[model samples]
Every structure is written in structure tokens, then in C-alpha cells.
Target: MLKNVAVALVDGVTPFEFGIFCEVFGIDRGDQGLPVYDFAVCAAEEGPLTMADVGFTITPPFGLERLEEADLICLPADRRAPVRDDYPEPFLDVLRRAVDRGARVLSVCSGAFVLGAAGLLDGRRCTTHWLHAPALIRRYPAALVDPDVLYVDEGPVITAAGTASGIDACLHVVRQAHGAEVANTIARRMVVPPHRDGGQAQYIQRPLPRTACDTVGEVIGWTARHLDEEITVEQLAERAHMSPRTFARRFLQETGTTPYQWVLRQRVLLAQELLESTDDTVDAIAGRSGFGNAAALRHHFLRTLGTTPNAFRRAFRGPRAVA
Candidate 1:
């Protein structure tokens, strides 16, 4: 259904963020049996657009009129997007009209600011890059901003966090349109993980202790390989040659989460993969993912993903797969 796509660019566009839109939607993947979108880059104004932080200019062949035909309109991050209070009214008006007519809109990083300028983010739950979250909130006070998650999807609008999370948001759109099999195939071609768990909290940098310790890292690798087996803080401590309390303390410092929390997240991730890729029953998947039973798995899955395992499978299972 998402056959037509357009990327609307203003001046000072970040090359990487702009390229993210191009990579996901603009590529010709028809040889691989993937959907090839009718994609175009539309300049928001007349004259060549300048690249941010780099001294170069690009002249897009398409103008704002091209956006009128797009099913999905993407806004990539630009340095001026968040800081500038005044945006081109004509550009903003086009975006407003596009959304009013049932077209979906997505923003990457600070690009959410453009949506904010268009009044599209008002009363919507959205997010921007973690570094820019406070600024986005200050500018658009009515927008509910969640800075920790990789992205926020609120029906017609999708906003992604800094940089690479754009890939996740774009892949999510593909998944919704086609199914997990198509999304996974594209992810495989891109050489990035099809799914990522937890939040940007794990990626936040923290100062490490002066003393070097590979014990926690080694235990984590072991636990991943042995996820089907029961693991506990005490057992992990024994393996690391440390007391349970000491192990827990170090784990929180190093991994930004407790041992149990990390293992549980990993199990849920495994279960999601199985649900998408295989025809395994809930009971079998639960056992393989270390939940031991379907009920426990269901509880965790719902708490983490806001959906049941069966419902998730029903939504994501490939069309060609047996029912």
C-alpha cells in the first residue's frame, strides 16, 4: 500500500539522516523480490540546498508539488530544524495538508521539530534525538516527549531518536505494510539487526571502574548461549567468582540493568524472533526461550511489547507461511 514515498528537505540537512531516508525508501530492491517505492527528493524551497557541516550543495529535480502524490512523507534531521523558531509557512502548509488527507508522516532525529512547526506534533506522543528532547519539548510544550525509546509510533506519525534508530523506524513501517518476512529480508540485506531490545538507556555512556573486569562480560556471553537454561543472580555470581550482591552491583554499573532484567529481555527477544520466523507453538517457544510455560511467556511479552505472543505472530507472520 505504501508505494509512493517522498523525502522533503530544507536547507542545512544532515547528510547521514537524509541518506537514511534514501537507503530505506529510495533504493531499487526489486531484484531481491522487495518492494521498490516510487521515491523522490523534494526541495522545500527554490535554489540549491546546502548540506550541514559540509560545504556542498544539491539541487533536487522535484519541488514541493511532488510531495502531493506521496503516500509517506519523511523529514530528515537538519541543524536548523530545532533551533529556528520560524519555518517556511508554505512548506508547513503542504505537510499539514498531506496529513489531513490520510498520508503518514515520519521524522528522524531533530526533524521532529519540522513536524512541530507544522503543528503536527501537538497533543501527540512523539520523540526526537535524546540530546534534542529537552529542546523539542521546550519549543513544542504540548507534545508528549519520551526521550528514552528508540522511536514512537502514533498512527499517522512516527518519530525516531538520533541517527541509526531511523533504520528501526523505517523497517517498522515496512513491517506494518508488508509483514515481518519482507522487513527481515531488507534488514538482512542491510546487515543490521532486524530487531533491537530495551531502550537508548543501554547506549548511554557511563564511566567504568578503574579496575578491569571481564567477568561480567564473559557471564553475559555465556547466558546468551544458554538462554534455554534457568539463570539466576546467585548462579551467575558463582560463575563469575563473586558474591551475589557484588555481582548485582557490578552488573547494574556495567550493563545499566540488573542481571535478571537483562536475561528476561534477551529471552523475550528470542521469543519474538521465533514468533516471526517459525511455526513453533506458544508452549514450545516458551520452553525454548526459558519462560518454561506459555502463561509466563505471555505475561512477559504483554508487559514488554503491549501485545500477546499469539497476536504478535498473527500480525507479523509471513503471508506465505502456513496458518
Candidate 2:
């Protein structure tokens, strides 16, 4: 029975996040046997609202008062959202009131910050884009912020991390309210996955932040240059002109990771490059990236990236690319 969807817009709103809600709820897809909600875009502040990083202004058809009647209020990511602490009180109040009245409030990316300001996320499990998760956590300590998730559905409050995951979250709402068949049909029309679990880890790739190493500098550079070779701490220590124990300690101090872990992490980055740019077979890429074989490559890749090599390729290079 979920209907009357309204997207609440604020200053510096991101068009992509706003568009996700529109694509999911604003459009009239009833002709295809889909449930079309009563949707409207509302402005939180008066006058034209500027888009984030874009040189255009959009005038919403409705105002903050319109949110009071909504079955679902969608809050999209905004550029000023994370730093700009002073949100319109009227805007935040309506959101709180809506949730109190049993209306669901869904936020995408940094839009969760608005909910946090409204005190809606207090003591509730929520998530935001991984890049912004730390900021969210620091700002809203009362909110249980999980950075490693695609989305979190805390009953009436749903928070989605990043862009595609926002789409996944919306489809999740559709799946819950209507049925799996409806959600699947909508996913087919949008050409996206029908169901990506809320618990799926965000594919976060944190590369080595340093090319300029200290003490163990030469060894670090040498390791990067020779990723395809089976490297050991003893070999690295000898190359660094130190004992194995001393080298290991210095390696941890200088690079913040053990020799073995650094090698494995770098090899995965190399494997990612091979998968994306080159038409290399998984087995071939595995050996070339020093994984010995595809099985080892798959194991390390999944462990670090939370996704399989083939799946990563499909997502990065598109479904047409042969894995």
C-alpha cells in the first residue's frame, strides 16, 4: 500500500542521486503493469536550488509541506550536505514527523546526514558511501554507521551507500511493498540486478598510498617492479641489506604491512588492471600477476575485494566482455 512518493531536495543537490529516485518512483510505468506512486519533487528551501558541481538551477514543483503527506520521502545526496551543518529546520522537522507517523524515509549516499541531523538515524543501523562513512560516523556518533555495506534496511528507515546501491535499495523497497516479480520486472526494465543483498560488502580497493618509501624504499620499489615473481621476506631482507627479523620489523614500520601482505595486495591490483584493460584469460593473468594459477588469484581477489574476478570484470568492463 506504499504510494505518494516525494523527493525532498536541498541546496547543492546531486543530480544523479535525485535522478535515481525519479527513475524509480517518479515515472509513470503503470502501462507495463507496474505500481506508479504519486510522486513529486519538493524544495527544502525557497527559490531555485543549485545542483552540485553543475551550473544549473531546478525549481521543485512542491515545498517542504508536501512531505507531510508522503508515504515515502526520498533524500538524495547533496554536495554541501556533509559539511554544511545548518539544514533548514522546517525540512528536518517534516522528515521526523513523517517517520513518526509511520511514513518511510529513504536516503541515498550522504543524504543520510540529513536524517542524522533530524535525529532519525539515532540508535538505528544505517549506511552511507564508504568514502563518506568516516565523516558520517564522526558527525553522528549516535548512529550505527556500517561502511562495508551496500544498504541497510532498518524497517521504516533505509539508507543506501553510493550510486548503484541506491538503485538496489529502491528496488528493495519495491520488492518489499509489491513483490519480487514486480521488483524483478523493474530491474529488467532498468537493466540492473534485481537483488543485490544489503549485506554485500562495498567493493573498496585501497591501493598503496606511498611510492616514496623510507629506509625500505628501494625494496618497496623493487617489489612493485617484480610483482610477477614469488617474493619472500628473506629475499627482500637480503636486498635491503638487513637480517630477516630486522627487515620484517622495518617493513611493518615503513610500509604499515608485512612483506607477504603487501605483495598479495599489489598482485591483486595488477590482476585488476589485466582484467579491465587486457583480453587476458584468468589463468594467464593469474600467472602473469604472480598468483601461480587462477584458483589462487580468485582466492586473494575475493578476500581483498569481496567479489570474484569474473564478477568484477563484468561490472567494470560490462557484460559483453568475455571473462
Q: Pick the candidate with the highest TM-score.
A: 2
- Model 1 lDDT tens row, 173-279: 99999999999999998898778765543333323223246988888888888999989899999999999999999988988688898899888888888888888
- Candidate 2 residues 1-323, lDDT tens each? 89899999998999999999999998899999899899999998886999988899999989988999999999999887778899989998999899889999999999999999999999999999888887999999999998878889998899999877889999999999999999999999899889752233426666555634454887888888899998999999999889999999988887778889888888988898889888888999999999999999999888877788888788778866677
The Cα local distance difference test for each model comes to: 0.87, 0.88
Off by over 4 Å in 1: 205-323
* Candidate 2 clash figure, as a count: 0
Instruction: Report the alpha-carbon TM-score of model 1 versus the true structure.
Output: 0.65
* Candidate 2, RMSD to the unseen true structure: 3.8
Clash count list over all predictions: 0, 0
